[model samples]
Target chain A: MQQNDYTYAVARIRFKETKLLSDADLDALLSAKDTDAVMRLLHDKGWGDGTSHTSDELFSMEEEKLWSFVSECIDDLSVLDFLRVPNDYHNLKVAIKCITRDIEPNGLFLSDSVSDAEAVYEAIKNRDYNALPEYLRDAAKEAMTTLLQTSDGQLCDIIVDKACMEHVYRLGKESENDIIRLYCELFVASADIKIAVRCAKTKKKIGFIRRAMASCDSLDIDKLSSAAAEGYDAILSYLASTDYRSAIDAINTSMSAFEKWCDDDMTAVLKPQKWEPFGIGPIVAYIIARQNEIKAVRMILAGKVSDISENTIKERLRSMYV
Target chain B: MSEILNNSGLFLALLGAAFATFMAGIGSAIGVGKAGVAAAGVLSEQPDLFGKVLIFQLLPATQGIYGLLVGFLILSNVGLLGGVEEVSLLKGSLYFAASLPIAFAGFYSAIHQSKCSVAGIGTVVKKPDQMGKALILPAMVETYAILALLISILAVNGINGIQV
Candidate 1:
C-alpha cells in the first residue's frame, strides 16, 4: 500500500481509538442507576443515537445489540475473521451438547462466521460424518467415545476444548503474518498459562493438565507440562525464570495473579515492538493497545461497582504495554 | 574519458546526494512542522501533557537524519573526502540512481508519517499518556525510509571502478 493510504488508515484508527471509553467515561458508566443511565451515557458520546432514543431499546438485554454497535464502527472484517476460531469452538460445543441431550437446534446454533451453518447443523444432526472438517470429525468421535465409555459429559467438553486450543496454537505457529502470529501466540500462551495456574491452585491431578495442554508459541509446553507433573510450587519456579517472575510472589498459591501477569506481560512485550517498520505491527499494536485500554477500563469499573479500594484496583491493573 | 568521468561523475553523485538529502529533509521538516502545529493546538488544550505530545511531533524528523547519513556514506565512498576532484559519469549516475529511491521515498513517507502522528496527537487530546503508542505508528512508517537509506548506502559503496 502507498504511504498515503497507510496514513489514512491510521487516521481512521486514531479516531476510533479516541471514541473508546476513558477512565472518566467509565466513572460515569458505573455511577449510572440502571442500564437506562448507561444508554444515556453512551448516547452522550453519540453511541446508539439516531436509531434508539429510549434506554430500554438500547439496553443489550442479550449481548447482541452491544456487539452489533461495536461491529458497526469497527467494521474491519478481519476482526470477525480473527474471532471465528473461538466462536466456532463454542458453537461446536453447543452442537455436541444438543445432540447428546436430544435438544432442538433453534436457539443452539451460533451466529458466528460459519461458512455454511446449515451444513454443520445437518452433519451434526444426521450423524453423517463425511460432511464435517477432519478436526471436527475427530472431536465428535472423541466426544462420543468419551460419552459411551465414561458417561461423563464434562470429559467431552474438556476434550473438545483441548482440541480447539491445539488448533488455535497450530494456526498461530503457521500464520505467515507477524501480527496475526503474535496475536495467536499470546492468545494460546495465555490460555495455557491460565489452565496451568487453575490446575495448580485447584490441586487437580497432573492428568487433567496433560489432557488440556496444547503447545503455545510463547511458553515452553514441555517445561509447563513438566511443572504440572512436578506440582504447583514447581510451576511457579519455572514461571519465575521468564519475564513473568515479577508475578510469582503475587500469585503465591493463586491463579488470578498469574492470569493478570500474562495479560500485562503480553502487552508489555508487544507495545515496544510496535515501533518497528512495516508489515502490520502498527495495526496490531493499535488494536491490542485499544483492547488493553478497554480491559483496563472494565477492570476499573468492576472495582468501582464492588467498591474495592483504589490501591487494590491499581495493584490489580495490567501493564498498558507488554 | 576516465578524467571526464571522474569530474562529472563525482559532481553528479554529490549533487544527487545533496539534493536527495535536502529534499527528504524538507519533506520531513514540512511533516514535522504540520504535526508540531497540531500538537501545539492539542497541548494548548491540555497544558500538562505538552512534553508527551512534543516527542510525537519530533519523531517524524528522524527520516531527514537517515537521508543525510546515506548521503554522507555515499560521499565518503566516492573518495570525495580524500580531496579527489571528480570522475566517471557512469559511476556518478549509478550512485545517483541508487540513492534516489530512499531520498524520494524518505521525503514522501516522512510527510505522510507526520500526518499520522498529527492524527495520533488529536487522539491524545483527551488521552495524554497514549502519546507514546500514538507516535509509534509514524515511527513504523518512517522505518521504510531508514531501510531505504541503508540500502542506498550499501549500493553506492558496492559499485566499483568509478575512478576519482
Candidate 2:
C-alpha cells in the first residue's frame, strides 16, 4: 500500500558503495602480513576506529562498527530492511545459545533495535526465555525448542540460518518495489542453493535438509525437493537444467566453490536490472555490491592467512565493479 | 472548394503534431534526467566505465525520438512539404491519428523507462560490465512507444491532404 522512497536511499547508497572495497583493497587485504596489518587498513578506511583488540575482540568490534554504520542509514522502520535481518538473527541465536550454555554473554550479539541486551543476557543466564523482546520471541522460542529436541549444535545452527533466509525470502515477495524484490529473491536463492549443495554432498537425510533449506523467491521448491531427495548429484543435474547451470559443476567438487558460485549467480542476475531509475532497485543493488565486496575481502584475507595457493584464491574471487 | 481544406484544417493538424511531440518529449526529458543522475553516480565511482554507462543512460531517450519522428511524419503528410497544399477532413484526421500514439505512448513509456534506468544504475554500481543488461530492461519498457511511432508514421503517410 505504500510507495518506496528510493531517491534519497539510492543517493546515500551510491555514496556508500563508492567507499567499499575496491580491487586494490582486496589485494591489500590478501597480502597483509598479519591481523594487525588488516586492522590498520580497516582503520584507514574509517572502520573500527576505537578498537585496539585482537582475535575475537577485533573481529567482533569491527563487525559491530559495520552493523552500526549500516543501521544508522536506515531512516524508516516500516520499509522491511533486509540488510539487518542476518545480524539480528545471529545476535538472537548467540543470545539464546549463551543462555542455554550458562556462559558469559559475549559481545557477539549486535543490534540497534533491541534495547534490552542485558535482559536477553539474563534470560539466557537464568534460562528464562520469557524475558526476551516480543518481536524475536517466537523465532527464539521455536529455535530453542528445536535445539532442545535435536541437541545437535549443527542442526540448531542450520535452523537459525533457515529462519534468517526465510525472512529475506518472504520480504522479497511482499515488496512492491521490483529491485528490492529481485535482491531479496537473489539473496535467498543463493542461500538456498548453497544449502542444497551442502545437504546433497554431506549425504544428510531429507528431514535434516528439509529443516536446513529455506525457500527462496526465485527457486522452484517442488523441483528442489525432488532433487534434494535424490541427493547431491540429482540436485546438481536439476540446477544445470535451470538458470544457475553455471554453478552446478562447482557444487559437485568443492563447498567453497559452490559458495562462490551462488555469489556470482546473484551478481549476474542483479547486474542485469541496474538501469531502473526509481524505487528501491538502486539501493538494493548498492547493498548487494557492498555485500559482495566484503565477502571477497574476507575470503582473500582468509586464504592468505591460511597459506592457500594464490591461484586457488584468485579462482575464488567474485567480480568487482569498476 | 478546397480552400477550406487548404487553410484552417492544416493549422489544426500542425497544432496536433506539435502537441504530440511536445508531450512525448516531456516524458523523454524526465527519463533522461533520472538516467543522467544514475550515470553520473556510476561514472564517479568507476570513471573507466563512463562510455558503457553513458550508452545505457541514453537508451531511454529513444521514446522522445519516437515522438519527434511521429510529429515530423504527420507534418510531411499534411503537405507542409513540396506538394499540393489543400487539407481535407481525412488528411486532418490522419495527422491527428499519427500524433496520438507518439503523444500519449511516448510520454507514459518514457517515464516508466526512465524509472527502470534508475534501477539499472544500481546494477552499474555492483558490476559496470552489466550496464547493457541494465539499460535493456528500460529499453524493453520503451518498445511500445516505438510501435506507436511506427503506427503514426504509417498513418500520416496515408493522408493525402496536401500536394504542395
Candidate 3:
C-alpha cells in the first residue's frame, strides 16, 4: 500500500493469488492416479486452454499466460530483465553452437526472453554481433570467435555464462528494489556454485574454473574457485564456512537434490512476499511462484508419464509459495 | 495596515472555513482515488465482490464530509450564508485557530486510513470471508480523525460564544 505506484497491479495480483497452488493442492496432484488423472486435476484447477493438448503444450500455454498476465500488470518489462537475461545468454550459446555446426536451432531456445531467439540466431548467422544489445555484443562476439577458433563448445558456454552472471550482478547492484537485488544475488551465486561444482567434477584447471566464476557479494570467487579446483570436498568445505552451510546435506545427496535445495531455499525466502499487499516484491514473488507451479506440475506429469516412482518426483518438486 | 486588519474579521473567518474545507477535501480526494483504483482492480477480477470493495472505496469519503460539516458551521456562525456579521478580528482569529486541529488532522488521517483500506482490500481479495477482520484495520484509523473532529467542533462552538 505504501508503494502507490503498484497499487492497481498488486491488487490484481492479490486476486490472482487465491488461485495459486497450495501445499495441499500439490499433495492432491501428487496423489493423482495417472498422467491423465494429473492432467484432469490441472484442468479442474482452470489451467490450460480447453483442448486435448499434450502435457508440454499445457505447460507452455501456462507460461505464455503468466507472461501475458505480468505484462499487463507492469508498465516496463525491463524491471524484470534479471529473470529474462539468462535466456538471452542461453540463446546466444545455442546460436553460436548451431551456427558453427550449421544446424537449425529447433526447440533449443527459450521464448519471452530479453533478446529474440530468432534475431540472435540471425545475428550470429550473419556475423553481426552489433545487432544485439550492447551488453551482449561483446559476449556474442567473443563466444563466436572462441568457438570458431578452438571448436570448444564448453568454452563458449563459460564465456556466455560468465557474461550473464556479470550482467545480473550489475543489475542487482543497480536495482532499487530489494527483491530484485536478492533474486539477482541468489541467481549469480547459485550459478557460480553450480559451475564450480561441474568444472571440479570434470577436473577443469583452476584458472578455467576461476574464469567461469562470477563475483557476488555473498560468495568469494577466490575461495570458491580454488575450492572447486581442489575437488567436491573442498567446495563443500568452503560452502560450509559460508552462508550456504545448510546446502551441505543436499550436496552430499546428489546434484539433483542440490538443485531442489536451491529452489526450495529461494522459495522459502520469497514466501513472506505472499502477505505483501503492494510493490514489486509481490509481483516478482508471483512470477517465481507461477514458474515454480509449472515446474512442479511438469515434474508430476513427467513422473506419471514415464512411470517413475512418485517419491522421485516429490523429491524434485520445490516448495509451493502459497 | 492596523486599521485594515482590524476590520478583516469576515476575511479571517472565511479563510478558516476555506482552509478546513479544501485541505481536508484534497486529502480525501487523493485517498479515495487511491482506494478506488485498488477497488477497480479487484472488481475487474471478482465482479461479485462489488458490495464489499465499495465500502473500502468510500471509506476516505467521510473526511470530506467532516470537512463540509466544519465549513458549513463556520460559514453559518459568521452569518456568511445569510446576513453580514460585524465580527472583531480577535474572534475571527480565534475561529481560524480553532479550525486548525481538524484542518491538519483530517488531511493526514484520511490519507493514512486509505492506505489501510487498500491493504484491507488485498486481505479480502485473498479471504473474502474475513471481511470483518479486514474492515477493522482501516476503521481503527478513523478513531484519530473522529477525535480531531470532536475537538474542532468543540473549539468552533466555544469560540462562537466568545464576545470579543
Reference-based lDDT, each prediction: 0.66, 0.69, 0.87
Candidate 2 ranges beyond 4 A from true positions: A1-4, A28-74, A77-80, A112-135, A217-229, A272-277, B1-164
lDDT of 3 by residue, A32-89 (tens): 9998888898999989987879998898899889989888878898888988898899
Question: Where's the lowest-lDDT run of ten residues in candidate 2 chain B?
Answer: B155-164
**Candidate number with greatest DockQ:** 3
Ranking by lDDT: 3, 2, 1
The TM-score values for the models, in the order shown, are: 0.58, 0.60, 0.97
Error of 2 at B54 (Å): 21
Ordered from best to worst TM-score, the candidate numbers read: 3, 2, 1
Please give me the DockQ of candidate 2 compared with the native complex: 0.12
Better of 1 and 3 by lDDT: 3
Model 3 CAPRI rating: high
Candidate 2, A143-220: lDDT as tens digits? 788777877668678877887788777777888777667767767777777777666667777777777777764577
Model 2 quality (TM-score): 0.60
In Å, residue A175's CA in model 3 sits off its true spot by: 1.2
Which residue runs does candidate 3 get wrong by more than 4 Å? A1-4
Worst 10 residues of 2 chain A by lDDT: A1-10
User: Which 10-residue span in candidate 3 chain A carries the lowest summed lDDT?
Assistant: A1-10
Stretches > 4 Å off in candidate 1: A1-8, A31-39, A46-82, A104-119, A133-135, A176-179, A201-205, A269-279, A282-322, B1-164
